[model samples]
Target: MHTLFSSNILSPPPAPATQQNPFELLFNSAATSNSTASASNSSAHSSPIEYNLLTRRLQDERRATEDARHVEPTAVRRKGHPKLLLMGQRRSGKSSIQNVILQKMPPTETLYLESTNTVKTVSMQSFAQFEMTEVPSQLSIESPEIAYSEANFRELGTVIWVIDVQDDYLSSINSLVHTAGFLAENYPRVHFEVFIHKTDGLSEEYRYDAFREVRQRVQDELSDVGFGHREVAFHQTSIFDHSIYEAISKVVQRLLPQLPALEALLNRLCSTCGMQKAYLFDTASKIYIATDASPTFLKDYEVCSDYVDVIVDIKALYGWQQPAKKPAGGSDADDEGIGESVVTFERNGDTYIYAREITEHLSLICLMGKGSGIDKRVLIDYNVSLLQDAVVEVFKV
Candidate 1:
């Protein structure tokens, strides 16, 4: 991997000098996991370390306000987060989505846009385990260093190619298709996902049409290039709606190997609880990490997302209403955070929503049939305890 690095400006961190090094703890596990996967086919395979990223980060604010951030050509200060690169044309809202997801920047801030000129890496650990790097649109992928670096990585990366959904650019589509095809073919281990961005301002019908048009065209091009439809995934993402967060969750979930087990546990919970569906949602972003086996309708996600908002908003209002009970050295899980939440409201007279707190950062939302003849609350409460243990065991891996 050092052969691909001219400088350690954006390289992964080194080993721990002390036992308390958090960076080492975080990235060392990544390196260990990378070594475990052995390719069955004689395809190109390099170390599966997360350093060889193909994703983008938010441009440094100082640079966004002045000039684009400069990629510091210095030695590595610490081991880095797994990397994801943003590769796209001009004004594609790459920096905006990067900022919202990584920096927790408000979506409103992205309205005042500025062009970036250099590659920038930003630290992000709250969501996924990757410190994303954003390459400038002006940076040519034809660069030997980038191509060589990409060719050497072994981990399955997520490439979110941002597309300006509002624009009419045949040339951009041509460029996008060609680059996507080339990368998907060469980097079989990498996931190439297309984001039809900045569609929030459009009408719902128009947005769907726009996404469909772009998706079909991209798929057609990939088919012509001798690739299957499943080779690439397309998402309609925008900062204004929950779609972006949902799309990002899908991208991040691809990187999480523990998700399948979690989903399996969720499926068991759903079946055992006599519920129609169950969702394991991330509290910070309101994005579901896993769910039950039932086909997830858009209505389900939106409804559960709103249900989470209700839980959070109520907690914010009444969190101070209760007296204090503090824990010892560990963090407090109760006071402001939800210990339990239950509400049964009719949606379509016969359908209802049932939500409960699982962990501090995870929640379970179950859609139930009104006439199941079972005590759902009791069953769900009992299963939540088991689900909690399963969640712990899954992440412990």
Candidate 2:
């Protein structure tokens, strides 16, 4: 029996300080006034010092405004939702099975191909209580290379191998088993569900025989690998059958308990936060960050809800100006390199910071002037601490 559980188990982190300080606002207002004065005196022949002072003051005022409006550090948690990866040759009724599981027609038709060219993700909201993400047909068993390379498959919770009993390939269960083996190796923890779909087209006797044969084949393969008979489960399902839905629901119920933490994190992040997207960054590589952009946010930000994390160094990538540094030992002759700015927050007696250049990627709308080189490593380290603090504080785990 599959157990269904709510993914929204984690609580949202504390809201960051939204309001700006009065002094900061006043300084900005004064800077604007100075800019106005400078512009008015532009026609008069102003000395180089006056002109330089005005320009520098204006730049400072702009930087201060940006800093004041900057967004506070926030971390998003990836909730464990029941992700089902469908596998099998093309035209195996895979899409039809997905439609039934989702209780709606598939967003698009499944296609037949020798190999998958790209990986696709579909989020079904019909099961709002439990999130469901479906792997696109392009990366199914028919396209082994694409399936193996797709990053989305790494996070799947279950592999639903859909087979068309009437198709010519139905006689051979080897392909299906091989796909299952691939999934088992890549995602060892994910469960397996073999659905002998298109049973509606088969006679009652033949359907039963096909189902039994496929089930036995899968079991034998599993037993050969030293895994017990209980490792895999088979279901004879058709789009027309209502009981198939029940079977799917039951499977979900059984798997929920094993992934409480992941489910809780996702639920909290999706429900309480104004932003529907969050990212996970790899500290060592300074790359491999993941984000799920809701449909609404996708238009503005070309991000998807799928676990697509792009690797990049925020400072070097964004071209933020480095802050100038004073000599460490008061040696006027020695010039120290500039340092990068990072956001910081404290949680559970631990301080964490996430250092990234303020850019469109992070929704930082302010403009920063170019300056000396800031230490990229320092900024990255601080930002990492900030992220850790946010996660620990918000999730309490």
Give the local distance difference test score of model 2.
0.42
Candidate 2 worst ten-residue window by lDDT: 363-372
For model 2, what is the alpha-carbon lDDT of residue 247? 46
Q: Estimate each model's TM-score.
A: 0.68, 0.39
Write the residue-wise lDDT of candidate 2 on 274-382 in tens digits. Answer: 2233333222211112232232222222221111112223333443343323322111111243222333233422222222322112211101112211343343333
- TM-score of candidate 2 versus the correct structure, residues matched by position: 0.39
Report lDDT per candidate.
0.60, 0.42
What is every candidate's alpha-carbon RMSD to the true fold? 13.5, 24.7
Off by over 4 Å in 2: 1-78, 106-118, 126-154, 170-172, 225-230, 258-397
After superposition, which runs of candidate 1 have C-alpha atoms over 4 Å from their true positions? 1-83, 127-130, 142-156, 203-206, 226-230, 313-338, 346-352, 372-375
Candidate number achieving the greatest lDDT relative to the actual structure: 1
In candidate 1 the C-alpha lDDT for residue 231 amounts to: 62
Residues 16-106, model 1: lDDT tens digits: 1323211221212333334322211101221223212210111121122122112432322223233566778888888888888766688
